[model samples]
Target: MNVRTEIIAGITTFLTMAYILAVNPNIMGDIGMDKGAIFTTTAIISMFSTLIMALYARLPFALAPGMGLNAFFAYTVCTKMGYDWSFALTAVLIEGVAFIILTETNLRDAIVNAIPASIRNAIGPGIGLYIAFIGLKNGGVIASSSATFVTLGTITSGPGLLSIIGLVLTGTLLILNVRGALLLGILGTTLIGLPMGLTTFGGVAGLPPSIAPIAFKFDFTHVFTVDMLIVVLTFLFIDMFDTIGTLVGVSTKAGMLRNGQVPHLKRAFMADAVGTTIGSMMGSSAIATYVESASGVAQGGRSGLTAFTTAVCFAVALIFAPLFLSIPGSATCPVLVIVGLFMLSPIRDIDLDDYSESLPAFICLVLMPLTYSISDGILIGIISYVVLNLLGGKRRKLTPTMYVLVVLFILKYVFIG
Candidate 1:
């Protein structure tokens, strides 16, 4: 709660997830958008949106255009669905508008309340595995394989070995209860990479890239088609659950949750909705709450002041893009693995004595990482929960909203997916 500690925690959070600045542009570039514009837009939207989280909601969480959702936008929607970037951005805007409307009403809260407590409890651990998987993949400790889908990367490879070393070092620091363990882990790993030729330093400072190419580029025309509707729904679904999961997971881990629910839920939800709306207008993907904010929480950040400081740090990073971007994936990802552990603390709250509850929760926990989609994991978990309860003659326990969601999820996959 101390200001100095909060500021330091903010810096730690920002550095741990700064890779999004460079990686967002690269991924979107594959879809023919200008990389520099995407980079600038990513940073600007993240700064302003995260500022909203800090000032309005008084939470220590940060916001950014999400990683997996961006891939879906670039590769699946734009590339495979044949929608242009502008069209896809239009869908994002629609999704954001829908989110704002839902959050402002009883709908958002109802949806949150509809989720089984066991499944809600499982979200943290599920996201833990998801974050760890991302760290391993990005750090080159794991690689995709034709034979078995994924396999361990060669330990001798420069990035792979450095990541292993960083993981061990960071895990050790966490075991010793070191303050700023995540931040120190990243910096230490980056230093180790310098000698191994894994990290390259660019100039100390430079002007941020221009946002002109992508600014205000959304296309509303020709968006009334069925495909576009599906795209919008996909954006909406992912944005909804991802934000919900992160808020629940991080807040629970930070001891900010009360009565198994988030306080100020509407404000937090609006922050994410506003971010997505602006990101689409700014020509970026859907923005959501970042689970990496748990790193700040783990570092003793307890209030909005931490987020405000982190926003300031992100703004400062804009001028030193090269210096920040120079951090190798091998360096930052160790924080993900460590933060995953912090998030998984919620698992103790789950009721393992009930098979019906435990089975659905277990499915949710395992599917999140395996499917690589929080929304998908949630979808199946709900469906499974409903089915199990009904078959067990516990149908009276199901909420009306839960039944509605099960049908919606079923229709979503059948028609859109």
Candidate 2:
């Protein structure tokens, strides 16, 4: 591979995804994790995990703690479930170990195939809406109402006004096909927020914070509880499908798929599995392959060198902890809203003409944002899909695994959830 081109491609990919550096810390910090420590851990995990992808998988893909999964860890598991962040970390660790086993045994596909295509397709968009809602709330664009349950915030001032301005600016950049649109938007918003007293400017560069307080802080006391099982399974399901989707989509774009099959697929899965496992120990969420790697592939990245270059970039980013940590939720929240738009693209692929499929998919998509729980969306989606299809006389379309999932979900609601 041409070194210059590969380096450029790698930088391109990193810029497209580097917003995660600020956003993940903000999300996890909500649950009382040290933002500085999370920032360091995020960079470290991203650097090494992506290194694994480069050397072991020999692919031009990058890994980082994922977006929606982090939200679930902070909001659903910790805040909503009333569990500590350590409990969520332990669940992530278990999920990673389970993912490694599944990948090694080649049983990942079996589990993937068992889920209905409609429900599978719905998960991403469901999470998109959920994340977008969080962005709006965080940015003061949405507010809770005592009478109506929710209402519009004062969009003309404060964080709300700033977010609206950022949204338009960022949307314009996206329309112009700007590289690093999200990162640039965050910086621009932070700058704008300065006069409004919304963004605080800390010193730009500093030594990375110590991760000692959060690292290896997993709580395994609840490992045998049903709640832990649900959390772990949710983590596995989202990461597994999301990684596979990214690999397939990016590889297809890069012409790396032979006969509609991704070469070195197992190795790629292993890299993601290992990343998640290691990331938990570093006190982060489930690490997964980023679909933004498509930007690098589109830049003609074709070998492991591109990923290696990206890993090096993350390593360098550790020194900028102060700059990244200073970014306010108002600045990063707009990126979340935009990412939600990106994730919603898959909804176009769903066959809306079929009620049996579309109805459950619609339920899955809506429940995530409304219920504020990704796991609940998936669980209820599967249950409705099975019940509707079976009663609608389309029993042949139901898989044995789907049936099993429905029963388990029902028991979860009845017993634990």
Candidate 3:
């Protein structure tokens, strides 16, 4: 890549990925997370994810602790189900490691191959809905209620209006294929909010003047416990498949993958797995490839430089974490809706050859929004695949891993419930 072009690509990449660094920790904290650990972990994991993409994968991509999974870690695991942060974070770490192994073993490919195309189509929309829900929840636009909806912060407030404006502006930029659209949208909105008193401290995300936050006390010896391993194993698969889907979609956008081959797939995946492993040690949530950056990459990014720029930006943003907190959640909402739109682009190509594939794909597409859970949507889609396969009289079509997923699904229900 030309140096100038690389710089531009890197800048764009940074803008696209930076939001997660400032946002994920807060979202994760909503589930009983100790503030110190959440901030430290979120920052460090984002670094690892970016570095892996730049160095190992050498692809112009980025990764992080997925937004949806982190919320579940907080609300479902730590709060509702009563698991400790240790268990939840440990689970994230486990999932990451498992993702690594799965990518290495080619088993991940086997599972992806097993899914019917219809369900595959559904994954994008499912994920889009999941992401949109996350945005709303974080923005305080939606609150949980008994068989009903609740609103926390209303759009009528000044803060709410600024946020909504930011979202609209961000979404517009994305649609226009503007460079550094995310950064511009956020920065512009935050600046705009200052005059209106929507921003607390001039709308900049900055580190506290005192010492930056740190993580929980380390227990290095326990890193190898059976529980840790199991957690890592599960996340590994989840993150692995998730990234694959993203890579496939993004590669298609960039014309990087022609036919069945995506050049540098192995390298890209390796970087992500290594990033995940690095994340756990840093006291953060699991790290995995972020497909959303594809929007930036698709626009013209073409080298690891793009990802490296993103990582550097994340580190810079961490120094301003406190200011980052001041930006109203509503401002970020538009980006979420916009991203939801971008992610939805892949749904057009899903194969609807038979009900077996079509049914699961459609179900997966709808369930992400309805269940309000990405993992749940994926699990449901997987289970549906197996059932549809058997029902269609193609029992052999179910892979061994699919069977394992079925068994694990049952256990997850019995145990998690």
Best-fitting candidate, measured by lDDT?
Answer: 2
Task: State each model's CA lDDT, in order.
Answer: 0.80, 0.93, 0.66
Tell me the spans in candidate 3 whose CA falls farther than 4 Å from its real position.
Answer: 34-43, 114-117, 143-153, 158-162, 192-198, 202-234, 257-260, 295-300, 392-396, 411-416
TM-score versus the correct structure, for each prediction: 0.78, 0.99, 0.82
Candidate maximizing TM-score = 2
Ranking of predictions according to lDDT: 2, 1, 3
Worst 10 residues of 1 by lDDT: 320-329
- Over 166-225, each residue of candidate 3 has an lDDT whose tens digit, in order, gives 887887886797776776787677778777876666334444332123243234454665
State which candidate, 2 or 3, has the greater lDDT.
Answer: 2
Off by over 4 Å in 1: 1-39, 54-62, 65-88, 176-179, 217-265, 288-306, 412-417
- Judge candidate 1 against the unseen true structure and give its global Cα lDDT, from 0 to 1: 0.80
Looking at candidate 2, the ten consecutive residues that score lowest on lDDT are 341-350
Number of backbone collisions per candidate: 0, 0, 22
For candidate 2, the per-residue lDDT at 152 reads 97
Q: lDDT tens string, model 2, 302-348?
A: 88899999999999999999899889888987999999988887788
For candidate 3, the TM-score is 0.82
**Residue 333 lDDT in candidate 1:** 68
